[model samples]
Target chain A: MDAKVSTKPHEMLAATLSQEMAAVNALIRTRMASEHAPRIPEVTAHLVEAGGKRLRPMLTLAAARLCGYQGEDHVKLAATVEFIHTATLLHDDVVDESGQRRGRPTANLLWDNKSSVLVGDYLFARSFQLMVETGSLRVLDILANAAATIAEGEVLQMTAASDLRTDESVYLQVVRGKTAALFSAATEVGGVIAGVPEAQVRALFEYGDALGIAFQIADDLLDYQGDAKATGKNVGDDFRERKLTLPVIKAVAQATDEERAFWVRTIEKGKQAEGDLEQALALMEKYGTLAATRADAHAWAEKARTALELLPNHEIRTMLSDLADYVVARLS
Target chain B: MDAKVSTKPHEMLAATLSQEMAAVNALIRTRMASEHAPRIPEVTAHLVEAGGKRLRPMLTLAAARLCGYQGEDHVKLAATVEFIHTATLLHDDVVDESGQRRGRPTANLLWDNKSSVLVGDYLFARSFQLMVETGSLRVLDILANAAATIAEGEVLQMTAASDLRTDESVYLQVVRGKTAALFSAATEVGGVIAGVPEAQVRALFEYGDALGIAFQIADDLLDYQGDAKATGKNVGDDFRERKLTLPVIKAVAQATDEERAFWVRTIEKGKQAEGDLEQALALMEKYGTLAATRADAHAWAEKARTALELLPNHEIRTMLSDLADYVVARLS
Candidate 1:
């Protein structure tokens, strides 16, 4: 097939589901407005309309459409997913004291941290309201569990981010909490709302879980080896922040005594000298951790593609399969 | 009837519902624990096990028992109400930059703002899960709406707390959002779980709403006039903080042109001299706003008592009625 060079897979998914995405957008706008608190819509609009890919909501829409859903509730669920995502971003900025997000001033910077925290809360309540409107106890259960996992994952990451004792298992748990939990919940609810069979729902969940892990792994890898222009982040940003992502976790697992001392000084103690970033990169390369990390991303992407085979083949399905590949395609 | 000076009305309610309150406490402790994130419990325990009045959850338990609820779900709902209350308190401390709560170091102060924010979110999500377990859509709706109201009220208060245009209605709206929404939801969900008559359910909501308003007004009133030793706060903390509570709102409304300038300088611009608190108090006295505000508290408390007339007369109901009067009993 001849490729359209300008368009991405998510863009194709958006084109195919433009009508439903529009409904989701409209619902998001309407729901984000506060009758009393005008500050709500301002902060929410800044994040929601910041040209985010809307990838999570599209997963919901795509999975539902793939399962032959014709109902309007999928739109509500999509909006719910996006609201949850936006709420977290607002709080994440506050937690991280981030000044920029998606190449714009974060809500915490534009407004006060108080506004960011409370408005993030308002979005969370709004998301809960949206999910409750679905009238599906099963959907509520999934989303609520996802919410807990996401929160727990965040707390774990906060405590574990710089700890050298954080192994691969702990890293994966944090990854799932911060990223994959929502992705899987987003897709799982799509199949759930469509009343798909148990096996199909499980498959949908596997697809999203694998896809999100791959997405996050690729993101972390890109922090070290990615083009700054394409990734919109400088090389070694995560290393500078002292975050122990997959590549570092992999390298740390095989560090020598001297190397361990270096990890402790830089990551645990947060004492960095000049050339630390280069040294960290060299260590990862010495252990082939970055390449191994890239292989892990591709492996997860493969799992995501394989999971899609359980569902009916359609235009959306094909795009979703390609989207998985696209998430890891930048790794090289 | 002879008065028991040893116990407060809430204490009496606690004595009457001891078994159920134990269950609620247990559920809270059990649910607040995170298998992965130790920080979750550390932050939550700092606030939850802090000697808070637990008055909101007691409202849930009292209302449930007052309506003769037999099931165990009320405990879960009561825990859910407390979780929501605790979650808000955690966020509130962050929003307020509070150093202390319940006369102890606040969770935000004890931990970083990140832990407070994320743990508060964990509790909120846990509350959502507990409510979902109830399987009552109506119950979930009340709590969701309450959560939204609570957040909106905080946002509204953030913007309107110092604005001179804030009037009695806006004060009431802010009060309802921050205080009464949970109180009413606490009670409403109780009656809901009991399958009580709609009239009784409405009465439960009305009782809680009025009681919460009266409770907040009395607290605010006490801030200006109560014993600092008993209230654990210095007089004029609100005025010092430039908060536009009921007393300040009333005084601002009746202020003359020169007095309006005083308010704009003091509350709006947050400029205060040594005598500003004295001057503010004098303005309230000049307009009889303190007396008038006391009257409003009494009126709301009376409304709370009147609402209870529709509920069945039981030990819990009587205690609840007295609880309404007890809220305003602090006023001179």
Candidate 2:
């Protein structure tokens, strides 16, 4: 840890890669423009400018910098990662029928679903173009596959999200496809562009993959108990939406006949009523599912930390490891 | 035109590259599947198995073969083109709120908009992965830009479709963006994979571009006057949809004040009433707008045919040139 700074791990990583992050931000602005379609830039600017941590792009930049890279392709790769992340966020809002994101009205709600869908497609194309400029077919292969995996994960979630029969394994698969795939690709491409050693590149990929899984697990858990002011997400939103995240899945697996009927009435039939959210939390606590889910998140975070040992020792690597801890730490 | 056979140009092109077309179809079938997300293939199969002619992939194969490409990469490139085309069609159905496609229910209608959007995205990602496997960065650059242009065109059409002030130039830009971009990419990548000279590649691109424009124009005109049984489209469908196609643009240019009010009510304000279609047709007849629109289609078809003369002498070349003529000849 940096004793002189009170910054969190993600904020510390962003500060360390501030110059590269600035380049990525600028490139995102430059590339999202359309000569004929002004709505594209308008819609994109609303979401892209609605500030988040830019964690995915920072991972790319940090991996490259930690590998002692001196070339400029890392900037392009960082922007590519951000574009892919942003594109998914756009489409996810449309698929989830979400109204709010990052404490603001989502692009879909403000503009329209058509704008969100088309602009998301535009960003995907822009990301591919950016990656192709890197001239590494290997990098293209990784990102392209990541994109497919991300979409596949989303499709799986569509079928698997609300169904009471969806198991923990399916939930894990969905998370890996939608969340970790991009994280690994983002970090792997960074190392590949820097011409890092195979071992280090694989390490970066592992670090990102585990960190993303832990991060998602924590996020899902937080949705039930998190301070809405801190997370900017309304607790019980997923329950209201009938999403079968890990905690609910764990609780459902242990449910009695009566409790199962409650799940069916609420999640499957969408017959939610007042006090249902409280009852759902009571069931989760009855089965100790929240504690179990938190344990899984910690395990994934520890795996992420352990993966960093394969990389060459660096300050960025330390930050990445702590970032993993910070992911699960929020829930605790 | 070939003197011996009684087949149309597209059929001739397909027959010549039958094996390659089969391979492309098989590759599409294989690649569209997701082990975890069976919904991806299920949705894609609804469109892929809809029995529409594999025109775009055939163009890729024909161009590659005409340029004497004796490699397997063309098959991959052809599948890439088809996937991209299919992906766009899925998204287009959602954006246009279209129910029917090729006389069958669209993927969006058969499933849901979420399936259409996410599966279209999956196919797009799969297309990029296919193109990347070709190991040609130039091809990636071309296809990626084309994808962006296609999305931009769709966005433009969303705004331009209802506005009476949208001119022919804007309509042409939309046509180029939505349809011609993919056609040009399909043919350009074909010749590019063959390692053809820059001039021949340019010729292939021009041929695809002009042919796509002609094909779209003919289809639009067909919606006004052609046999709905043959075209699988209702007469005046675009009019009812408030689309500002070429014929409407032409008539609107020559509209009298009363006629302008009619268009403003029907198209701009979307206060369409009965007898609007008959009056619109009579207005077009008064202004010779359909004839003018037909002339534009024929001009583009001729431009396409002329561009093919720059390619080497081959049977496939004859079929492609004839394909240009056939694109407009259907309207007659």
Candidate 3:
């Protein structure tokens, strides 16, 4: 435990906050069961026990503790966060027709699309029940908005996919809706439920927002430069899927006539062929878009770090700041 | 309006509650939209404006008025109920792989599964936001449980399919989880938000539970017997799908060896052949289960009617009682 505490931001926070996370895990286990539908627990257990880092919920616990909350609601709120995230992941896998997640077969692959969609919904409803238990209207408002925004972002991506003109503005909007909204809500609710000052709550929200954007940008960048072993994803999977991530979007914006024709044939039309991925990589290098996307991620990480200064000085504060650095550190 | 009020229970309720229903309609129209994801509204409008009777929302509005609610929160609650109902229909169409609804193509058939699932999710999140706006924790608890129950019911149905061992108890449990739970929630929240007495709230819950069960049983029976034009569904669609609804469950229990072979060949093995739907229908008649199922629906309808006697009487009370009768009246 001592060796791990100094190794990673989230792991250190988890080690420091083990007891509360245990309570959150227990709450998640208890609430996920149904008297009539035993299938729910089976599907949920497949995903929840898939050995995720539980980073978002830990953020909630860490934020609440750092803000001096000596109460119990944070556990419920953290569980809510995890449930919402897990629900979206389930639905997302179905939507993406994904076969694997985190080096294992996705829930949709194991069961079916019907199970994934309905079980995702069950978890979402379960999440609302959890947040309501927190008894904070402000917390409800944050999470509710986050949920809507997450759906909206996903829908936006659906409409925007395979289109050449989806710009950076739209890309950021999608990121905010799909990824950052929950992050901000998870952190904001921690401060809000703790009855922290409004400025601190706002600071927490900003910190989460920037951190999530950085995390997503870093992820998109890693899809291009990341190791299949380290990231547990085949490199160029997004390219193969024709997804319009940041690196590709940047490369598209800078494409010459020949390059634009290549993208249109390969991406817009999805007529990808042998050596096309290599050609796409060559064009990206020509545009230096990988470096540019990496820079953008670094800047967002810096923004996240800056926002942490507004938070009250505490041990968790250092962890959160380090967490921001760790998000971009993945790119390095 | 006067002409309409005397024609049917739903028409009567609509005529009596037109003004308030208008507000609920307006709220639904405004809230189902998204500035970011216009597809949200497009998909919702396809389902919401398809001209089905807004029965669940009417239950909320009717229960509120019967309980002497003169405030506006009922509109939010009613809208919440409709959003939840609509959200479920969208997801249900996808799960059932249904092509049509209320004589119109389903949103899943018209758009795509991703839009249906994500838009359904957006509507659910919007429902939670609407319910939260009512400022009633009791209402939240009731509806959240209903949402969870709905998903659980659907998942239960998925697991219970193609299995001959699924009995009447499981059928009723599925009915309660999927249909009656929402109906009960719609009425219970109406009373709870009005600050009505606990007994009245319990009565409303009982009324909705019975009504929804009756309504579902009636629907299953209709699928076998009703005119295709009147029901907007081809007769025996459930049989074709090999779904083990209540009507078939009852018949299967009393099946002779020869009848069991037919069921195994058609339903369990799904090796459906010519005259199989007709054969299934003939077997149902031979066992007298259709009439027996109809009798069960009437009993539930009568139970719904009986539950209303505990409520303080109002004009809408009569409409609700008649609505219970009308739910099963279609079977005749």
Task: Tell me how each candidate scores on DockQ against the true complex.
Answer: 0.85, 0.79, 0.76
What is the per-residue lDDT of model 1 for residues A1-332, given as tens digits with 9 covering 90 to 100? 43564367898998889899999999999999998788999998998889789999999999999999989999999999999999999999999999999989999999899999999999999999999899999999999999999999999999999999998888899999889999999999999989989999999999999999999999999999999999899999999999999999999999999999999999999999999999999999999999999999999999999999999989889899999999999886
Pairs with steric clashes in candidate 1: none
Superposed Cα deviation of residue A131, candidate 2 (Å): 1.0
Error (Å) of candidate 1 at residue A282 is: 1.8
Give the per-residue lDDT of model 2 (tens digit) for B9-59. 888887788888889999999999888788898999989998778999999
Ten contiguous residues minimizing lDDT sum, candidate 2 chain A: A1-10
Quality of model 1 by C-alpha lDDT? 0.92
For candidate 2, the chain B TM-score comes to 0.96
* Candidate 2 off by > 4 Å: A1-6, A255-265, A271-279, B1-6, B256-258
Best by lDDT: 1
Report how far residue B275 has shifted in candidate 3, in Å: 4.9
Fnat for model 2? 0.84
Interface RMSD (one decimal) of model 2: 0.9
lDDT of 2 at A101: 90
Clashing pairs in 2: none
Question: Candidate 3: lDDT of B126?
Answer: 94
Taking chain A by itself, what TM-score does each prediction score? 0.98, 0.95, 0.97
